[model samples]
Target chain A: MPDSSMPAARASTLIVVPAYNEAATLGDVIRALRADWPWVVVIDDGSTDRTAAIGEAAGAEVVSHTVNRGQGAALQTGFRYGLDRGARQLVTFDADGQHSSADLERLLEPVVSGRVDVALGSRFLEVKSDIPVLRKMLLKSAVVFTRVTSGLRITDTHNGLRALSRAAVEQLDLRADRMAHASEILDQIASHRMRYIEVPVHVRYTRHSRAKGQNTLDAFRVLIDYLLARVFR
Target chain B: MNAFQILGISLSSCFAILVVLGVVRRRLRPLPGAAWAALWIAAAIAIAEPDLTVVVARALGIQRGADLIFYLAILGMFIGFFVMYVRMRHLDEGLTAVVRRLAIVEARHRIEETARGEHEASERSPTD
Candidate 1:
């Protein structure tokens, strides 16, 4: 196991989990994360389910949205909260229980060590993740698209499992407010020229989590976002 | 000019003149008015020289000039609709953020109030 002690520069690490209708698994996810990293902030993105209540009961500082904004906006809110609390490092985690708390150490190593400004968790790197074949193809296409557009050379572009140093988080201005924000983050990483590294992490693809994954139709919106970003810039 | 050509030219001239007047009167932004004026002029040219569309269409690998114009007009309309849809979505997101901030603040305030009320109740019961 990687060292459990927090790094010097990243003493107060805050885990930001943006949840939207994941009440079924959110409590367990928060509990697991809080076990290792105590500072947990859950942005309940307007879920009709008991997501916010469950998160609050699980001992997490819950920030809730009254209306359903996308995951991107929720994550930004969490980040802002983290920043206000003076977090040295900020982590973006999924609330669907696919991301392992065990991988948190690995994901944070580079960022915490000050070797890289950002640490991205790549399931395809070394771990044997059991993602579906079609999903794998879609992810590969996304990587190629990111490379072509954002010029970010990384194995994964859309993984929610990642760590950001305080500086990196502060510099990123995320505006997509939707699924496209994943690509927008990569675009920001490239434009900001922040040193980034990909670490191997395992992602368990449960049936529910798979169902919650982005649909193929959303690819068109991502493409439009990419084109719009280029044009507007 | 043929009857169709004459009609197209007249309508385009009227549109161009109106756009100019609107821009001069500050009723419309110059950039958009200029764009509209240019579009009307282009439409007039295409209508007058019907063969030009055919040539441009062939160059673009399309069969007929009329079909090409039809496709372009449809595409432009779709693009305009999409842009408006995106703008509305953006406004909706901003509203969501504001609502979310209010929700969070209210929740925190309610929690604090409940805790304070419980503390006061316990203190008074002990005194009584």
Candidate 2:
């Protein structure tokens, strides 16, 4: 548990974990987060399992969707909840235990210190993690796609680990209710001209995480969804 | 008229009448109802005078009347699909908003309940 005498800034920072049927790993993820962060909210995306129960048992606030609305909607719900509770900073972390709580402070530093409105985690920044060959290729391709489309020049386009200042939180309005929200966030960052930076973070691709993660084909679907959204909007 | 033309015209006329009745009874808006009626009427005319389409097709530089109808049908289907896709996307957004609001409200209630429980527990405890 986080010490009660922790600084107000750390205490006010809300870590939002968007989960869908993550009963196998949510408990450990929340427990690890709660050790350093006081405010941890798990958005259970209509998991028909023990996800919500595990989250509650792990001493984290659990917000549940009545039906599956995808990870994008779940994160938006978490953002609204954190904002309403007067959180000074919000961090989006995955529920698959791929993210490390130890790296969270570094990820939140720029946002908390008011140096940047958004801090994106990039696994490619330091090349510390043993990334799978195929997954690495996919992520690199996504980086190029994001650069061409949003002109952000980011190294990682879809890393779920990120920190947002309150101002950035209020400025972002996510309409993509699925994986495409990652691209949408970058698009908004470019359009809004919000200050942002990338922080090196390690991603653990466990068998469970890899199994739960997006397939190679899903990248095309996300691209189509993103392009169509741009065209339609 | 041929038997197929007679049947096609009869069906189109019935659908056009239904569309007009729908608008009159306030079941559909006037503009959409009018569009539906126009489509049915056009179908009836094409069925009644098949040679007219050949003339129109030639003026449009199309080879055959049947080819013209097929092309028009394909174009119309594409337009219909586009409209439906846009409408479905809007509906999805609306649903996401509703679900997000509900989740936030329920989480707030849960937070309040937990806080109340803790406060009561602390009040009942002896000072260290």
Candidate 3:
């Protein structure tokens, strides 16, 4: 449990959950996060369902977009909200319940201790995660792609679970506005020369999460978006 | 002049006049409007003297005027699409910014409201 006596401590760490039409799992996710972290903000990215209502009911501060921006846009909104509220550390957690609240403490350890600017969760670092075969193959391909493009040696390229220090958060300029933001983030990290670490984390790939996850064809779109951004930038 | 040449030249001339009128009325910006006018006038010239295209194509190492026109049309289309895509991306980024600002402001208001309600509720109740 976080120390509630020190309000500054609570204010320093913020959990940002970017939710899009995950009304079924958002409430539970927020509630679970609120157990350990008091400052939880949910970016309801134009969900047609009751995502915002559920998030608010679960005791999370909910900010809602009027239109359906992609997950990358939602994450950027959450980052801005956290920064505006004077948060020193921001953690991005998936709303689809694939990411566990338990791993958050470990994921945030390096950043909170001022050891590294970012902590990226990697399921491939350890063999504990039971990823589907096709998904695993796709993720491996993405890892190779990131390594070649960004020159960053990391096991996972598309993990949503990450902890960023204030400096890292302020330096990152996320413009992909879609799944391509994952690669974009890594590209920026490499270019900015921010110190980063990879922490082994377990990912629960349930039926619901799998359904919400990206398919094979999205890899190509993400590649195109990343390449176009590079070329234009 | 052939029938097709007369018809094409007339249509292109009408478009060039419209473009000029748009520029004079300030309905279009100077640079882009000038570009449109130049394009229409060039089309008129190409239609009036198809042999000119053949000469230009030969200078460019192309065999036929029709082939040159086809390649130029495709290239122009690609450039047009690229420009539109860049503009669309800028618009998307702007929209995202506006949406993000609204969401943050609304969330702040909601938080303040909740805090005020809690304070009022505490005041209405007896202190321990």
Candidate 4:
């Protein structure tokens, strides 16, 4: 039975964090995301380390897989889990502890207000994310690629923090298995003609995060992957 | 005895030799495409000369040459479909997860951006 008294369906949010091998960072990130929103989910994708155990201890809804399927697969699990738990809006956060959970409130405001179907956290749109110079250049290229492909005017394309509404989540099919899937999601969103916005997102430049992000060689590889996803898909 | 029969024999022999070479080179990965191709060629030759199928099937102790080829070929196709289905599923699972995480990363980044600006401000100017 549909309730006629309900207002235009006020949206609730869940944070989905994908933990690869960041056992050391999982506890802090989960703790922070949960303090603001109780609905914090962590998907531990085939970590040879203690990634799953740490997330579980951090009071997150943990999903673990035995085989390593890549970041894209881990994120898919978190999305389905969050949606099943009655999350009206789903936000994707990194498990590397580079992102601040405090900004989630600002990120959620646009979506909850019904201003956009999707809201992305942009590291380059505002002040610098303290990203390395080479990584910064690579991200700029990724932004251009996404702008051209997705037809979105956002400044940062690869920024990890993004929010999606329930309808948007149901419509999206995030099936790319590797890094390029990041680019693919924008393509899907644009193709579906969903409204989206980019908000200033802050990323901490931890030594470890820098190591995990772009170097000269890795930047080249990311560029190759971004271009190839369109050509191959 | 017929021109068609001679042509059938020649094509079958050529194809079989090529498939055998593929198998020997280790390029053959038990694909059903090759199996189905083999079956069609064998059937074509058998049609050209029915006695040829009987001779081959009997040599392998099969009831009928058509029976033997049909069963083997059917099994091959089932295996191929199974492999293809599994590969498709693997791709689906991988893609779904990445896109979902992307949304999380998007949120977290926004949260972080505002948080850091606040942090910098707090340090620079004390609030009342």
Candidate 5:
């Protein structure tokens, strides 16, 4: 497998991992990422545990949030840091170990090749993960909602893994500090006319990650936020 | 006048006077204070002369003046709650922005400080 150790591969690329109380798993995630990616930054979203220290120990640039500002805020902070340092390519990876580091190459391929401004990982693309029936239904509904609202025909709407170009990242005005930011991002994509593609990437839905995934009630909140955005926009 | 009519008029008059006093004392701004004062004054007038409301209700095709007041009160409450909810949501978004900016700034400062400290420690080593 071709690695990012080559000068061309590592040029101006950054991996941003947003972690919230994932000290038990963040170290492994960061270590695996830092092994291949030269710039890996972990935003510790006010974790009560030793997540920041563990990330630093794993050779990641640790950025700590004084208060828990949710995953969306952490990702925005990471994106700002990457952009401020003149990163040409930025990948948003999960710190919960659900996302595979190997898939990072596939996710970055389209963006790095200049085919798309944003490449989003879709778990349903190849049936690579063990997604429950209920989760599949929920995600499908979200896809339909995105299609209807944003007019963007994408299969997976809320996947956490994505690669974005600097222009696309700069055009993003992320206001949702919570899980709803996924849909919000899609809205911005549609409005800003940013080119985006859904890449076939694998996600390991382990017991730990599924336990930390969005609950059924949180799905209702996302729906409410969508409606509120429409009503208030 | 009947005993209930006299009691209703007296109570509404007292409430209206209290609200006017509040407006005069600068406890409530003029706009909202005037609204409260107008509501209470209207209530006092309607109670003092029930026939007046009946006349207005009849023009509006309402059966009773009290029923019309009840419906208006319910609508007013709904509007009041909706406005308050929107205001609260705006304030919440503003607060989140402020908190997020502070967190990002403080985190950047701390990260820079740690990097500087580590750099100083590495420079002090004599392992050339």
Candidate 6:
């Protein structure tokens, strides 16, 4: 936290918030993020409700997905938009409001310092929070599989809030259309030889967050999808 | 094997084989399974019962069983092909719907962001 109070490098920081039917919390999330950073891009991912409208009201540069393209597509849209605006340090925050706004700096640490190309916010790292036992097991399994396949040594592999430098962001092409993109991003991290570090952050797992997180069945679907991709893709 | 009977089954079987292979190549993707299975079963029946071919051809006022199977194989093959074609059409529509909806949202989103950006810039102006 060397320059915790100061603005991160001359490399403009852009926050990319990917949302899917998050009309309830998006307004609050954007407002919190905008308190410090002015360039906030909210990808309203085909929400059937007023998600985009809410984001616009909160002073965020809102983009919409007419049809639901899933979280991965939304994040890709945000990332591409950030690049268009000349963002040197790009950070991704979950739309569900699970990540703490105060910990944004922690996620930005490695990226701002030029030490690591990407810095990921890990809820399971130093700052621990109440995660359901079921979620813990499912996450552990996914990280293990990803570690062995992608060859990236890091804990909390699937944490949604991650920061990437301009070089890393430009090189990382996340092609997966759905939640599978998290794993796909890791694959890019390994493929491009970008330096990545995981910093511990406080995750607020409220009732809303728990409702949004993946269950055992969803994890199984992801595993099956990954196995199938290996064979087909 | 009677020449007439062999000819009918061979023609139908060719159609049936193509349907089955095409679906299998799709890797059990969708409704093609039912159509593939049906074509295979029909081909089997045509191959197993030569007399049935004769009966069908005679019913259709044809002179031979070979003619009957040839026509029957062709019919079964068409049914499989038609069914698969319709199924693929349905899938295409679904994809179109999803894409169309997304396009609309993206357009609206760009306009809204532009308006918002102008408003924010005006507020930060020195004159204000």
Best by TM-score: 2
Clashes of each: 0, 0, 0, 31, 0, 5
Task: Order the candidates by TM-score, highest first.
Answer: 2, 3, 5, 1, 6, 4
- The TM-scores, one per candidate, come to 0.73, 0.95, 0.93, 0.65, 0.84, 0.69
Candidate 4 chain A: worst-modelled 10 consecutive residues by lDDT: A1-10
Considering the true interface contacts (CA pairs under 8 Å between chains A and B), give the fraction that model 2 also has: 0.96
Model 5: per-residue Cα lDDT over A1-233, one tens digit each? 11345566465788889999998899899888877787888888889999999998898877777778788778888888777767888899999999988888888988989999999999989757888888889999999988889999998998999999999999887766777788988899899998989998888888889899988898999788767755765
DockQ of each: 0.35, 0.88, 0.89, 0.10, 0.33, 0.20
Q: Could you give candidate 3's per-residue lDDT for residues B1-128 as a string of tens digits?
A: 98998999899999989988998999988899999989999899998888999999999999999999999999999999999999998899899999999999998897789789999999988964
Which runs in model 4 stand beyond 4 Å of their true positions? A1-11, A220-233, B1-128
In order, candidate lDDTs are 0.85, 0.91, 0.90, 0.74, 0.84, 0.76
Interface RMSD of 6: 4.8
TM-score of 1: 0.73
Please, what are the lDDT tens digits per residue for candidate 2 over residues A28-106?
Answer: 9999988878888899999999999999999898889999998888988988988898888999999999999999999
Instruction: Please give the distance, in angstroms, between residue B7's alpha carbon in candidate 5 and its true position after superposition.
Output: 9.1
lDDT of 6 by residue, A1-233 (tens): 01235464522788889888889899999999878777777888778888889988998877676677677767777777777667888889998889877887777877888899999878777787788888888888877888799987777877988989988888976545667778888888888888988889877887888898888888877766555434433
Writing each residue's lDDT as its tens digit, candidate 4 over B10-97 gives 7777777777677768777557447745765775667677877678878888879787678667997898898786687657655555
Clashes of 4: 31
| Model 1 agreement with the true structure over B32-112: per-residue lDDT tens digits | 899899999989889889899999999999999999999999998998999897788667756866865685676568668
RMSD of 1: 5.9
Per-candidate iRMSD: 2.1, 0.6, 0.5, 8.1, 2.4, 4.8
TM-score of 2: 0.95
After superposition, candidate 3 runs with Cα above 4 Å error: A1-11, B2-4, B122-128
Candidate 4 structure quality by residue, lDDT tens digits, A1-233: 11234333322577888777988788888887666566677777778898878887887766665566667666766777666657788899988878898788788788888889999898877656677777778888777877877787778878789988888888876555656668878888889999998888799988778767657786566566656555545
Chain B TM-score of candidate number 2: 0.91
